[model samples]
Target: MRIGELARRSGVSERSLRYYETQGLLQSERTSGGHRHYAESAVDRVIRIQTLYAAGLNSKKIAKLLPCMRDADGRPNEIATPTLVNELTTERDRIDRMITDLLRSRDVLDEVIDTAADGATTDPASLARRR
Candidate 1:
């Protein structure tokens, strides 16, 4: 399909698709007239790329992970390397920490909301005293 069709199907912008190509996360062929053409499988590839980006992986890391992923099932292939595994583990750990921090922040916000709902003092010093 063409870039427009890919972008529409994958819910990603054409510029993003081009950027993915430049980042080595996606592939396309040029026609005799220099128009880019992509295989039907490129749709799946774009979806996978979007998934990785949504998970907070940078383009470079996504590029590394893409080659090892099975397009059909989106599972890792048997080409695991120690370096790749380590990097992925580290990225997972960072995301875990971010989740933990976000949860803690959410808890604090919930407490504040509850306090406000109770008609508690909005003044910081008075609220601290009431607490």
Candidate 2:
């Protein structure tokens, strides 16, 4: 299919698709007239790229990791070098920390909301000023 069709099917913008090609995260063939043509599997490839990006992997990292990716399970097909394995492990740990921090923040917000709902929001500072 053409770039437009791939973009529509993958729900990624054409600009992003071009950027992926430029970044070597995606592949396409050029026609005799120099128009880009992609295979049907390009749809799955685009989705995979988007998924990696969504997981906070940059283009360079995604490019490096893409070749090692297996199916859609986020597993490595072959044994990665120690350095690459460490890098990916670090990224996963960072994501975990981010999730933990978000959960903590959400818990705080929930407490505040509950307090307000219980009508315990009378301003202590206002009371002091009145005194």
Candidate 3:
């Protein structure tokens, strides 16, 4: 397919696809007139690229990881080495911490909601008077 078709199918912008190609996260072939041509699997590749970006991975990291993804040909290749494994691990830990923090915030909000529902004024002055 062409770039526009790929962009439409993948729900990614044409500029983003071009940027991905420039960043080496995606590959394309040039036609006789120099127009870019992408394989059908390019749609899926774009989706994966968007997913990694949404996961907070940078373009460079996604470039390193993209090679591990197989093309339609099904050839096996390893993209990330041992060094990247450490980075991935660190990312995972950071994600875990963010999740924990979000849960804590949610708990606090829930408590506030419960207090309000029970008609409790949790103001410092009210609490002092109650004590």
Candidate 4:
């Protein structure tokens, strides 16, 4: 498919698709007129790239990690080494800490919300449900 098709199918903007190409997180071939073309698998690849980025992995880290993902044959890729494993482990731990912090923050926000609701809300049933 073409770049536009890929972008539409993947729900990504054309600019981001180009950026992903520049960052080496995506691949495309060039036509004789210099238009970009991608294989059908590029759709899945772009989604995978977006997922890794959403997980807080930088382009560099994602580039390394992408190849370590499972192959089409359902087997783990051989691209991961012990060093990469250690690095990914550290990243996972950092994400875990961030999750914990966010949960704590949400708890605090919930308490403030409950306190504010206690005064403004007259529906005891609704407030009880909230708590």
**Tens-digit per-residue lDDT, 34-98, candidate 1:** 87789998988898888888889999899888888886666666696789999999999999999
Best prediction by lDDT: 4
Clashing pairs in 4: none
lDDT of 1: 0.87
**Candidate that beats the other on TM-score, 3 or 4, i.e. the better one:** 4
Each model's number of backbone clashes?
0, 0, 0, 0
Q: Model 4, 1-131: lDDT tens per residue?
A: 89999999999999999999899888899999999999998888899889888878899998889888986567877679898899899999999999999999999999999987776588787779878
TM-score of 3: 0.78
Off by more than 4 A, model 4: 122-131
Q: Residue 40 error for model 2, in Å?
A: 1.3
Could you tell me which 10 consecutive residues in candidate 2 have the lowest summed lDDT? Answer: 71-80
- Regarding TM-score, does 2 or 3 come out ahead? 2
- Give the distance in Å from residue 28's predicted Cα in candidate 1 to where it truly belongs: 0.9
Q: Cα RMSD to native, each candidate? A: 4.9, 4.7, 5.3, 4.7
Over 1-131, each residue of candidate 3 has an lDDT whose tens digit, in order, gives 88999989999999999999889888899999898999988988899889988878899988877787676678756756888888888888988898999999999999999987566565776678788
Error of 4 at 126 (Å): 18
| lDDT, model 2 | 0.89
lDDT of 3: 0.86
What's the TM-score of each model vs. the native?
0.82, 0.83, 0.78, 0.87
- Ranked by TM-score from best down, the candidates are 4, 2, 1, 3
Candidate 3: Cα lDDT at 60 = 92
> Could you tell me which residue pairs clash in candidate 3?
none
